[model samples]
Target: MKAKTHAEEAAAFIKDDARTHWHDETLWHVRSNRDRSAQGIPEWETLRDTASATKNYVLSHLGELLEQFEANAKANGVEVLWARDDKEHNEHVYRILQENKVSNIVKSKSILTEECGLNHYLEKKGYDVVDTDLGERIIQFAKQTPSHIVLPAIHLKKQDIGEIFHDHIGTKKGASDPNYLTEAARQHLRKKFVEANAAITGVNFGIAETGGFVVCTNEGNADMGTHLADVHIACMGIEKLIPRAADLGVFLRLLARSATGQSITNYSSHFHRPAKGKKLYIILVDNGRTAQLGREDFKNSLKCIRCGACMNTCPIYRRSGGHSYNYTVPGPIGSILSPGRDLKQYSTLPFASTLCGSCSDVCPVKINIHEQLYKWRQVITENTNVDKSKQLSMKVAGMTFGKPVLYDLAGKMARTALKITPKSLVYSSLNVWGKHRDLPEVPKESFKEWFKKNRKQ
Candidate 1:
């Protein structure tokens, strides 16, 4: 099957005008809340600066920090494992479960696991895997990947979830009440929590100094699953590490406020060691992060705390929906990160942004997301096979703009063409930009001509 391009997927998302508008407005509301929360904190910018600088130091000293983390984690009775990529990570997880004689697994919301396709791999091996987070569980029941990172099923409405719950969990067909649905999910997940042989969680932050990891969640599912399960596995990318335990305070304050305008996550559970008779494993996966780090322009993206603030503030992401990006992580950050993984396969992702700079403005870690996106576009254009039309158009634009006389002549020609051309021809199938938007009325003369006339007067 041929994959849909970002444009096609985005078009499909926007076809439902009502849903599109709702998604845009909902994310903007979250962005608005983030603004209010940041205003309440006098030191918000300081926190961002500190967090970014701390992450930069961690990236530079990653090797020593990982070794230090490993030694201390071993001292704390926590097994630290390293995986160079997703395949190795999945194999390590499967081996742990197999060695433990595990059958049923309950996992909290872990974008790393989703990136590794852990559930699908485990399910193919015949182990029953259930996602315990409410948003995750809803999408699990729907047999769909998360549309958003923090809000997995944000694309779905209450009624959509009600329908899904009805089919899978025997809720009443017409039930759509938020409270009733939440209670039903709680009841459904409690059984899974008790029955799980193993639990997996995504690390929000790992402290190299103490060799402890934090998993922040509002639902407390990570705590419940790990508390009940015999084997607990926490997966994290290599970039999730911080140099010191105290450094956690800066990120924790920025994370929730930037994500959902909350003071903090309800449960910021820290796991330093395994409980008695229980096993704990931490898998630090690279999965192309090292290669990304080598790219000076893009390495700062690893500073991301996965707060989804960039997504909430992104104009394109809000309208196109997360699934349209066709990656585990979506939106501006994803646009910058995806191209690094596979330049050809993900070439279109970098172009999805409007380069509005809003994403970078709202980023808690202050990653230069928009700037990296522009750099990726330059890289992609030079290295990959872009569309012939787009290539020709860009070359023409470059030539026209390079010479002032050509530029002015082209502007004058465009004004004349717009005035005389029929609307149908001006907005024909070839004019992709004109499909959704109408061209502005033609001016009487070029700005250059008007400026030359007025300057002398």
Candidate 2:
């Protein structure tokens, strides 16, 4: 089956007006929480500045810090592997599993694995990987991708999840109580946690100085899976690294606050060393990150803590739904990150924004997200073959706007046509805006015309 583009998928989502409105308001509530939390902190902006600076330094000395991290992790008895891209990364994990003869694995909420398509790879290779986090597991059972990084099943309602569980895992049919479903999922995941021989997790922060990593989860799934398994593997993007242990403090404070307005995640589990007798494996993934880093305009996108604050605050993401992005990590952050991976596939993403700058203002690391989106548009327009009609329209608009007389004449002509044209013709499929939205009522005369007649004396 062919996948739909962002616009097509979004068009489908907007067809469900009730769901769209619910999604928008739900995310707005999260954004409201974030605002209240940030307002509670007097040094919030200062923390953002510090976090941004630290990431800048980390990027500047990335090679050296990576080396330092590897040495420290090895010294702490954690085996470290570097994967240059997704193929190599998946291969490395598969090789590790084969050597160890691991048949089943339990995983926490790891967006990295999702991005790399690891579960499908492992499943095809005859390994059963269970996503232990409730949200992740729900989507896993649904055979769908995560709608949001932090809230994987945000696109789904309680009734939807209840029905899914009832159909797939045998929860009571039509019982949609939050507590009941949570306990049902808990029991189900607990069994997997006990049965799985290995566990994998995604790192939120990797400290280069200490050669340690941290996985923050509200569900405690990371700790549960890691502690019970004989072998624990942590997958991380190269951008997850920080220069020092103390820098972790700066991020931890900002992360949960900006994400869901929580002061801290319920379980901020740290993996400084492999537990005694249990093996630890760390896979540091590149996966086109270095290439993105090389681009001066977008390098700062790596500063993201994956708190998903931008997605929560994004107006388009709320209305369009995460599936619209057709990406693993969907929303504003996804739009910025996805285009770098495949410009042809994601060319429409940068345009997904209203350029309202809420994402930039809400970002704890100050990534200049809106500005980057603007720059990406210019880059796309310059490098790619734009549609002939769009190109001609831009040229005409540019020419008219560049000359005052032409602009005035064009404005008058446009208003006159709008007023005279039949409603059906004026609001036909030919008008993109008219297809979904109402055009403002045309005036009988221009504002300039009224000004000259009434007040020019």
Candidate 3:
């Protein structure tokens, strides 16, 4: 929140060169593991293509599919709720809790809830909501949003978390050992799971054919919470629908391996019907997703299965921590998605990428993330009310580019100025790009000049 642009915030992370390198290498290692797992599967690309096709089908037939899902789910004794937006979604959840007379709830990892700001909204409304996922629980206690959607606390060092746990949950001071801290969190969260009167989970995929929803997790917390609670609620974006149960085979194959290098999550739960003697609700949320669907360039974003592979492969994301992007879902996909929601606040996001396209290569669902980022940049720059400086700079570049003679002259002048400029002034406040990075030396000749001399044209 303190940093306005991606560059400004990414600078803070880069200043600690050691931590930045560690973050970069850590994610690169995850990417390597993904490659290893993907190599073992002969049909990985085929699966990706099929997944994309499946999502395309669902997006095209969402209304019909969702109505079938609703009818089938009701026949199976599950109540279905449709929320048009975040405000209505949160209000629906609040009303459900009030109906159940429950003030305390245990929730598994759900970025949809985070997107809706439901935890904060419910807390302000006097209900106690406990995040059960280890990463979500850590960030929740820290009073911070998830740095990464899948690995929510990736930005926090174990030591930083040690300090937090020591203050909030009474871990021994200076105890940052992974096994010890995990055990402590386990003991603490186990009690909450038992005491919570209601539970919530995010749907990984909603099956229209069977009226069932899948919630995949490395931890078995979703099952534990739902089975223990009297009221269970599952929240999902309308985009999660995939039409049939057999389609899970393709997605489940790609999800965990791309996400964290596991063959699959330790738990791939199918909530076909509510737990015995318990009430269940599924809130199908349409939070600007319909609008995003209307955008042909960006509609592929809805195909994302939340595998987080794109985040691992993105060079910019690896160097700049997730918090740098200042969105619920950070990295390449987030950059493309956030601008559609709030252009004024998130206009900087689409420009955060280097257009490397590694994200599209690694996506489980083939979102074409880097292409979308590039497209979003064009859209935001042309359509949004951008700043005066950006407008003026674009205008100057456009005019100069339109005239070959002027461009050549301008290039010569820039090279001369760089050669003559004082070192102090070159790195001073006047040079924004050079403030954090050293300026490159001007070449003796431009490419055009070199080509002309070499070819004797």
Top lDDT model: 1
Q: Which portions of model 3 miss their true places by more than 4 Å?
A: 1-3, 453-457
lDDT of 1 by residue, 1-457 (tens): 8778899999999999999999999999999999999999999999999999999899999999999998999999998899999999999999999999998899999999999999999888898889989999999999999988999999999999999999999999999999999999999999999989899999999999999999999999999999999999999999999999999999999999999999999999999999999999999999999999999989999998999999999999999999999999999999999988888878899899999999999999899999999999999999998899889999999999999999988888888888888998999999989878888778898777789899978
Q: What is the lDDT of residue 395 in candidate 3?
A: 93
Between prediction 1 and prediction 2, the one with superior lDDT is 1
User: Which number leads on TM-score?
Assistant: 1
Tens-place lDDT digits, model 3, residues 154-222: 878899999999998999999999999999999999999989999999999999998999999888999
Root-mean-square deviation of each candidate, in angstroms? 1.4, 1.9, 2.2
**Candidate 3 minimal-lDDT segment of 10 residues:** 1-10
lDDT of each: 0.94, 0.91, 0.91
List ranges where model 2 is wrong by over 4 Å.
1-3, 443-457
Per-residue lDDT for 1-457 in model 2, tens only?
Answer: 7667778899999998898999999999999999999999999999999999999998888899999999999999999999999898899899888888887899998889999999999999988889999999999999999999998899999999999999988999999999999999998888898888899999999999999999999999999999999889899999899999888889999999999999889999999887888889999999989999999999999888898899999989999999899888888888889889988788888989999999999999999999999998998898788899999999999999899899899989999888889999988888877787888888888788889899947
Pairs with backbone N, CA or C atoms under 3 Å apart (clashes), candidate 2: none
